[model samples]
Target: MVDVAQHIRIFDQKPADELVPKRTAAIKDLASKLTGPKDVDGLMKMASNLVAAAKFDKKLPEELAQEATASIKKQSPAFVREGRDLELSTIALLAMLGAIDGGTKQGIIERLNFLSAGVWLGLSFQQPNKESRIEALRVEVLHAARDYVARGAENARERKAPALGAPLKPENTNLGEVVSNLRASVERLNRNAVVDREEIDFLWWSVTKWSSALDGLYDEASAYSAAIAFGLDGGARLRRMPLDVHKHLVLRRIRAAEPVSLAGLIAAVGDDRLRILTKIPDASTARTNPEIFPVMSSLLSGSAPKSASKDLQSVEAWTVRALLEATALGLINQHEV
Candidate 1:
């Protein structure tokens, strides 16, 4: 199994106000440790610890996050030489920091490319294994789709639309006539190949989300937060995650709404095959109009709201709840922002 970062359990029971002073001291201590090492092994271990700590605290200093992001990117080559495990670890670090730093779309894509390579290599080591082969095929399809789009963009650039002589009727017109048509086609294809525009928009929105909470732009924090949630579920041990932070963000919002029973919440979330949790008609109607999907609606809305003090104090609930609290902190940071 892949060794993924674990969310730090410290201060899990503390209120937001009480957590502040502890978080400040912890960051200060971690920052001090960072000053001691520049070696690859040391850096990897330190980064893992830093990420775990990050999962615990939402409002880490922007300058510190930026510094951590740069260090991880710079050390990518060394990590690659180490092995697949380390490379994956490095990618995780970059993904977390990139989101936190509100890094450019190009930066996130670069880390994703590394992730694809690492996953492919890991699967290669397990070749001839039944499960690995099945998983490899899925990765192959994504790669093919990516490549096809890239090729289409290149072809469009190379083969300009046939020049029409003089002014021609609309039926005879080519893409070049509109000026923006060819450019738009190439851009669209490139975007499809490289990344989705909606996701890029979400990344920026997450930056805004974090920035508003921090009283300054701390972009990509939700990306990191999503990663934290995924890691908690040990999803890293299974396969690569699609870069869709919005679904996870919506899940955080559902959690923010505060359900009474943790087990029931997970069960309701499990039935979301088409991701109805993120959609309104399917999930919300359970609250407003419970007859639509009785099983889901009932399970989702059955329990009355419980006070934070009344909620379960188990590790699983605490960590999941903390993610909600961390995200909600940004939403309410106005007078506090």
Candidate 2:
């Protein structure tokens, strides 16, 4: 039998203003407590207290929140040893609470980092021998993040919340190497290659990490690309993922290729491949119809100039091509209801 009553209880009963005068000292005390040894249950209780203190105290110093976020990340590595499933769930809940009520954009991003850490923990559980736990955590974390992190971001945006932060530019992260590594992995997979566990962990972790970053930047289309790469066909069982998530994954995956050249991109993945991979009825019609594929026609016109970074493209063009490539390689598939 299990009870989450303690999980939901108000663990910190201090008045909101109780810590105002000594917030720094209070935060230092909590941070010190975090550094000491603790079991899973103790850690959970401590985490709850940390979150409650912040939630109850609207004026909780931002320093406490930042320290809480950092502490969670530092502690995340223990998930595998301590049992990742429960650890991930608890950490996610605490992180979400902090994120939803956080007063600063940086704070929300910090919590999102914790969610990203949870995703990594789930991936780490993917061992060849432990198929059952791996699959269970995969489904659970995917849906949980979609529900808690993704929808939370969407809802915050819809409400025009100030704490969601100012609009962000894509990080200068050139995903060229990442894409190159993925292409090599696909080739190896095509040849029935048996990769070591380390490679598997690295590749999946890299994909999840980048996808989570894109999600943080609100580049849902590009991020969806990486997500599909991680999931592939069997992952289609993610019932909550939308159908339209199909097209964009392909575009962004290919766009991140090493050379980052427009001509190379076109030559590597032409319009024909795009149509076949996407299963679009008419490639030209889809491209020209701005409603369906805005900026796509211009991208395929051969006259469109490359952005300075070469990895940059209209978010509209990103959806289709990456989906196309991943589908062609048989790594990803269209979402099915």
Candidate 3:
């Protein structure tokens, strides 16, 4: 079996100085253009051009590439906040090229999250009405679900057989069963390449109904929390995670509301589990008290505890509950957080 974590480390390793001057010059030029309001579209085109250029040159380390992306997002929040698809798509394209060059599953999942977010954001910008927005979200959700199921199938194929005369561990056995079920679900989804409104309604029902079936097999809370963070962090992974696990995180984030930064989410959860899971830097830096958006105060006050504690279970529950509430209120679904 592939060691996903090890693969990520390999991709993260800094490359030796080769064409450093050229790469630096290219990045500096890109950064200069990214600073202006009108240059957002140009940046996106440049990102795509970079991807093509990367095909012939040595790919940048994942770390360097992601750093550049973060810088761009931070400098151009207006463009990102507006749900500019072209800009996001450019970021995804660059990441995709890096992942392809590196042959890392971690890279693939990262790319998918970016692609998925860009697609969803694009849909949101185009659909001005609530009903249309919901419809668009549902369609994308189905597509993401299908892609997840396909990935599960691939994982199933790669599963190694237990050593002869040795029984599989309980966790392994349970995972095997879950993968089997997932494969079966994919078979049903395959019958119709594009899921319609009626089909999506049925899927929603099925997901809710089968929620408990995977209880011991999956940690829904952790997955949901991670997704919230990923969404807030603009589809970037704060830490290393398997593609399969990260898929759940990103999908939930895509479905949930726009997340604040990691710091903001930690404050929202009002607990330590997320801090430990994502290794968040400092709570003091996070905007716990809502300023511009009073809705955030209402949401956090209702869900998060007033006092901080070491209770991880409460944190998980609070995060999941808060996200569900946000989803209902459509706070996390739209561009604004």
Better of 1 and 2 by TM-score: 2
lDDT of 3 by residue, 1-337 (tens): 2122222222234533442333333334343432122322222233233332222233433433444555454544332323323333233333333322232222223333322222222222121224442233234433442343235334433423232233355768666766666666665454333223323443343233122212221234444344333332322212211234333443443333343533445554344242332322222111232221122332334343343223333233334333222221221122221
* lDDT of candidates 1 onward, in order: 0.32, 0.33, 0.32
lDDT of candidate model 3 versus the reference: 0.32
Give the residue spans of candidate 3 off by over 4 A.
1-110, 117-129, 132-138, 141-158, 162-278, 281-318, 321-337
Q: Comparing candidate 1 with candidate 3, which one achieves the higher TM-score?
A: 3
Give the Cα error of residue 190 in candidate 1, in Å. Answer: 6.4
Model 3 clashing residue pairs (backbone): 257-332, 257-333, 258-332
- The digit string of per-residue lDDT tens for model 2 on 97-200 reads 33333323221323332332233222322222233432343444344433443443332222221222233336826466556655666654543322233234
Sort by TM-score, top down from the best:
2, 3, 1
